[model samples]
Target: MELGVIDLVGGGGAMVAVNDSTRTLRRTRSIQLDHVWRALETGAWVTAGFRSATPWLSSITGESPSASSVTLRLAERIQQMPQVKATFADGVLAESALRQLTDLWSFDIAGEFARDERMLLGWALKFASGDLTMLLATWLLHNDPDAADKTAQEQFESRELHLSSLLDSMGRLDALLDPEGFNLVRAAIRHLS
Candidate 1:
């Protein structure tokens, strides 16, 4: 499936437009991503509801999603590759890794900060390519204590709501990865750049 950027969206099927060609993939409103997780593991949902955007996807004639919602959802999913990789890699993950990875890569993909763009891209590509060491070290880049602590710190005191959402998703994902597994540190990581 074409795991690229999404342009237009609306409420029959979703369309994924690549640099050269454009293709449409059909989906259903009930095609919840969680169901995809039900049948597979991480990186397995490569083209379930995403086929509409990626022409190479198999025809999953299960459900139908409006063009707008599917397009938006596909785009959102593609956007989370970096953080998802972070969440799946072995070891306990903190919310800061999720925030920093998302923030850095989102800006990179959007081309908002060319000066710092390459730096984020490098980290994302490394993470996606299974660079476990770099993914683990990402937290170090965010946390600071003395001259800035490189260690992960708890954020339960200040960002209860933020942590709530972050943990909710990560917690669900954690369970998906390991049904009996769960990470409850309950905090977001802060990166000092």
Candidate 2:
């Protein structure tokens, strides 16, 4: 039975229907990601007359370019992670959790992730998406402190303070600083001001 907006809002079982629809949508997205992975693996997208998978996915799924790009990248990352791939395929894992895992994933920490996959999946199931993201980030930082340090150093090296004049007599101050630098600058400015 199809649920129109009226039925969705007026029906007694509306919440149940909404919950079921959410599960169905999650499963459908999982299937789509699986197909995207297969297409990437087989070059089926090229044969289907598309230059690349992202555009083809966007065309078919009606997702924006950035969403399609993220989906494509997630598909590639999920392919390398057997346990994550399975959990995602089961549709038990939230998309946000999957994205968080993919975001913090690196080849250097693959083994650690693999070993901790079960524990992480448990947290994914128990925690909200934001909590899961923070948990995964903390896990990554603790497990791969060297990579975290390297990223901090890169950010420090790339830090910039830009002062530009606006149209009137106004000035703009733009800065990109790592955590320590930001704290130091903030302290100095607060003390002086």
Which candidate leads in lDDT? 2
Per-residue lDDT tens digits for candidate 1, residues 65-131, read: 2223232333344345543433323222322333344433332233433344345445543454346
Please give the RMSD of candidate 1 to the true structure. Answer: 17.9
Give the 10-residue window scoring lowest on summed lDDT in candidate 1.
172-181
Model 1, CA-based lDDT: 0.33
In model 2, state the lDDT of residue 88.
70
| CA-lDDT, candidates in order | 0.33, 0.77
Off by over 4 Å in 2: 1-12, 48-51, 149-193
Superposed by TM-score, candidate 2 places the C-alpha of residue 142 at a distance from the truth, in angstroms, of 1.6
Q: What is residue 164's positional error in candidate 1, in angstroms?
A: 13
Q: What is the lDDT of residue 184 in candidate 2?
A: 98
Reference-based TM-score, model 2 = 0.65
**Reference-based TM-score of each model:** 0.23, 0.65
Residue-level lDDT for 101 in candidate 2:
77
